[model samples]
Target: MSNLTSHEVIILGGGISGLSTAWFLRQKGISFKLFEKQSETGGVIASEYIEGSVMDFGPNSLRDRNGQIRKIAKDLGISDDLIGISEAFKTRYIVRDGKLQSLSPNISSLISTKVLSASGKIRLLKEPFIEAGSGEDESIGEFLERRIGKEAVDYLADPIFSGIYAGDIYRMSKKSVLPKLAEFEQDYGSVSWGAIRSKKEKREVKPMVLSFKKGIQQLTDAITEKISDHITYDEVLSLKKSDSGFEVATEEATYHSLNVISCIPAYNLGRILEGFEPELSAELMNIDYAPMLSVQLTFNKAEIDFITEGFGFLVPRKERIRLLGAIWKSSIFPELTNKDQHQFTLMIGGAHDRGILTEPKEQVEQEGIREFCRLMQFDARPSVIRSRLWKKAIPQFEVGYEQQKAKLDRFEGGNPGLYFGGNYQWGVSVPDCIQGAEGLAEELAAGL
Candidate 1:
């Protein structure tokens, strides 16, 4: 409706990536503005407090590995609020034969675990003998099957990727998602050999899984407070390359900036660039996302007969259950709820279960509850239930993803003052977004 004065740089979207970029830019004494469509920031990282229970609508935790996140926390003055996961959560389970089985990592434990069949265990021992394939991209399923056998793909790789990406194992690119595994095969001729040799080389500090005393939103809130003066609550309707730089239009006003860092979803970015750069937009459109549902259920700890130890269990595709997996929220972080209650966060509907989203909420919830009861053999009902549907939750790093990524990188290289950052570009984890943002900010600030 009107024109606003141009700024030096405009960072679009107010999620962790965008916000962190702005924070980093501010440290360099650069002039910038942040545009967020929502009244509040943090994107899917939302938290709610209800009746003494803390519920996270999005990510429940973050893995603090390189201390970058801890430094961010310290810088934000919320280091005291950081909480580490319990030691008891070190154990994880996998569903097998309608029962929860312990997932063991070492060879001795793998031989003794009941999760895999005797034949499957035998197949695993053959991994070292299997020859590595040509240096071409392959799906996770294909890579696992080729190296470790089909049993590992069915019981191990499938559920793990499902939990992380809510993705299809047969479609997920091994090079893009699990580069280390790919490298092991290429460098050592076998994953097992590579792993063994790697262990002998050196030991790296393990990353601790963590969260804030309140929730992950605490981090976002802290960043928002630090950069409050630079943020504006306005929706960006469209974008066009201008003589000066770029003209970003909102519903009520237009603003021009010499540089722009788009940190929105891939689909949103594709739409925004449709008119200006159709070819780039077409490449962006190729990036697909998986829909997911996060359902939180609270139950009286005393009434439930099942033991709620460990982080929770993942269901294999062969299980034929609508539910993908459930996280033992209370067990992971006791502060999330009172002593009398245990909370479970269940994830349902992914690439394969897309139809479940269209089903009535009541029906879906009831079905999930029934399935959980049948699997875990629990007879009690949840005292409280909360659910949120994410239509485009996790980006699928499917086969041929590198091509599209390379195309976007080339587009940014060819076009000056246009940059891209988000979960879609580098990775989907909280730390990945922050690290990518920090790097992007440094590059952009240097260019200025």
Candidate 2:
């Protein structure tokens, strides 16, 4: 604990947030060190090569918005390895009445799609006429229902959003979950009209969703390569305010830094900050996370009769299913699997059902398989590559997120040289973290 070294900045956690922050900081030639409580740099962003398949136990893909992913990939000289979704496989499916129904956000498709009833479709058309509510934070579920009708919310919005945040829309904040949509409502008085106007004005392009050749971890690994010397693969025990600056005690040694930035999970950072900032720590702890169980398996094409293009299908809660959704990982990038082998990543449990993690793996797996097989109407036991349960996997931007956001903003003002920014502070996606890291790095570099 006595071995002390001074540095300009110290980064906590080596996930995408920490690594990306370090990459930008290193580019600025800022002297900083990153500490990760793991043997490797990537935290939840882990890739496993087993049975001729690249199984991503964490986020499977990166929806690159703001060009951050490509820019970083170019800077790392790995832009050549980037891949995107095949045009043929861009369809999305949602389960309704225990049947998988394709969702096409078009007038003709909306009228024909069985996911929403005829009346629901009529209500959807009425969105332009519906008056916008008073400006106030509301749940995503409520927002969607008020705008597009409840039927669409149940079959379309619910599962799609749940797939993203692993959260219940009824509890999650609309402002935090869909800021652009919320803004459109406030400015145009109708989300549908606002979207049409934005499109007419060519406001912005939808985010390009892509991933590296290896997996999502490739991005983290690339950043780690550039900043390898600056990272410590040791556990961060505690963080305290010291006479000099911020004192960080890790399992290996104690270090001091003039500036400290947290790129760790909210709960982890909360525990570390308990030593010096008890009130902020309490507030940080209040931010909740969703637990998830991801099962990746390989099925021989001959053994499965049903197969389709596009991303995957999500199981709406109304369908009375324990399975959350399954992504057609092989469809996204066939290179990740062997010839004639299809890989599917099944997700189970979320904010709605944390019990899946504690339940028996065999029972849960069987039930999930039973439901999936019923949907596919196939009878075959596929080879299970890997099944990993991620506890507190994704942060929930639930109701009252503003309070937490406000406190975090004030905390930085009250505490000098102490900054907190990560997925918890901005977004949970890889691109979101990268985008946030870029802005935060520039801000920190200027301050330094």
Candidate 3:
């Protein structure tokens, strides 16, 4: 495997992180190549076309807080392509009293919503007086319970938590997963006080929720279009240190580059770099990854009894459902919907119960239908169902996450020409991944 010529920079993995890096390199007019294991780009960001309706298998929306993502959209001349969710649909729902109940929509609802009992409401008032201990880190469940109450944590936060991370708040790290909560403890000494401070600071804050008018994949596709010529659709077998730079090996050919950026999934990265740095590889391999399964269903609008105007619903783990949450895709964006057809994207099998991910396709589909009917009260099956299983998508930021960061620090210090940056290295959202890529690009530019 000693055939291909070297380049200025070589990026492994062709997900959003890798693509964004390539895009930045193009803007800098630096020569580079991007290698992807898949035949096409967009690793987890994929969409399906069913009967003229666009359905997404991953990431239905991007938050407005994602400045990097917003900047990228603006730069691509597609900033106007963004869409906002409806106000009525702004309220989330949870299973309470064996029925779907609307959560607090606004400040008035927070004070009036029956989802919280009188005792729970009063318990929350005590949050302003509750004392947070001085500790390095704690679980999200523990932190929430300490700040508010168990009901607030279990009812208000748990369902949303389950839907987003498929992680048990009891095990998830508060410092790493929910740093805003940590910041509240640090600056205000109490979350209630932090809320007051945050309100005054809210004007400086940008929009906190958003999505592309068409689909999330538009962002990935746009980035790829900006750097399509430099990408390679080949599987990289291994990487090794060379006399001057680094050697990257694919099945049929080998290529050397002045600098290497490993953007593959954490687990995969660990294996590929094992021979080079066993200790760092071992630490990286220990970084847990949760499987993700998304099922997109399309139905005639009349077939569904309830009219969905808002985003969707989430099922808590205690609900004992086989699915996580469902996003009313058509309601969120006009481009993804048709006049007569309605679509919903159901995400299931997160970090805690990925076992459901390996189930037979037919079984998963049937289970999804059952859960949908049971939770949302649909009478019949959806007209079209498409399921995509991603076994190594969600990165698990479990307790002691600093260990992973330390390993990365050691690896980078030992390997001069090799660099690594991806979703796992930073935060897990689209904005975080884009920021990580941009930061790495700047570092690479300075080195060049």
**lDDT, residue 437, candidate 3:** 88
**Cα lDDT for residue 93, model 3?**
69
Stretches off by above 4 angstroms in model 1 are 1-7, 199-206
- How far off is residue 379 in model 3, in Å? 1.4
Candidate 1: global Cα-lDDT?
A: 0.86
Location of the lowest summed lDDT over 10 successive residues in candidate 3 = 201-210
Instruction: Give each model's whole-structure lDDT.
Output: 0.86, 0.85, 0.79
Number of clashing pairs per prediction, in order? 0, 1, 3
The C-alpha local distance difference test score for the whole of candidate 3 amounts to: 0.79
TM-scores for every predicted model: 0.96, 0.96, 0.93
Residue pairs whose backbone atoms clash in candidate 2: 89-310
List model 1 lDDT by residue over 1-448, tens digit each: 3334455688999998899889889888888889999999999898887667888878999987678898889988999999999875777888998888986556677888887889998898899899889969989899899987898779888898999899999998988998888999999898888888877864365678899988889999999999998888998888889987898987768888779999999888888888889988877776888988888888887888757668888998988888899888898899878778988888888887887668887788778888887877888989998888888899999989888888888988887898999998869999999999889888977776
Regions more than 4 Å wrong, model 3: 1-7, 202-205
Q: List the residue pairs that clash in candidate 1.
A: none
Best by lDDT: 1
The residue-by-residue lDDT of candidate 3 on 1-448, one tens digit each, is 5434565689999998898888888888888888998888988888666687877787777775636667778888888987666664686667665567676556677777766788998887788788876857888888889988998887788888777777778878888897877888878888768877877764444665666755788889888887888888889888888875898888768888779998888888888888877877788898887787788887777777766666777776666777778887777675667768888888778777767756787787678778887788778678888888888767877778866787787778888768888888867777778888888899889887
How many clashes in candidate 2? 1
Considering TM-score, which of the candidate structures 2 and 3 is the better prediction for this target?
2
* 1 versus 3: better lDDT goes to: 1
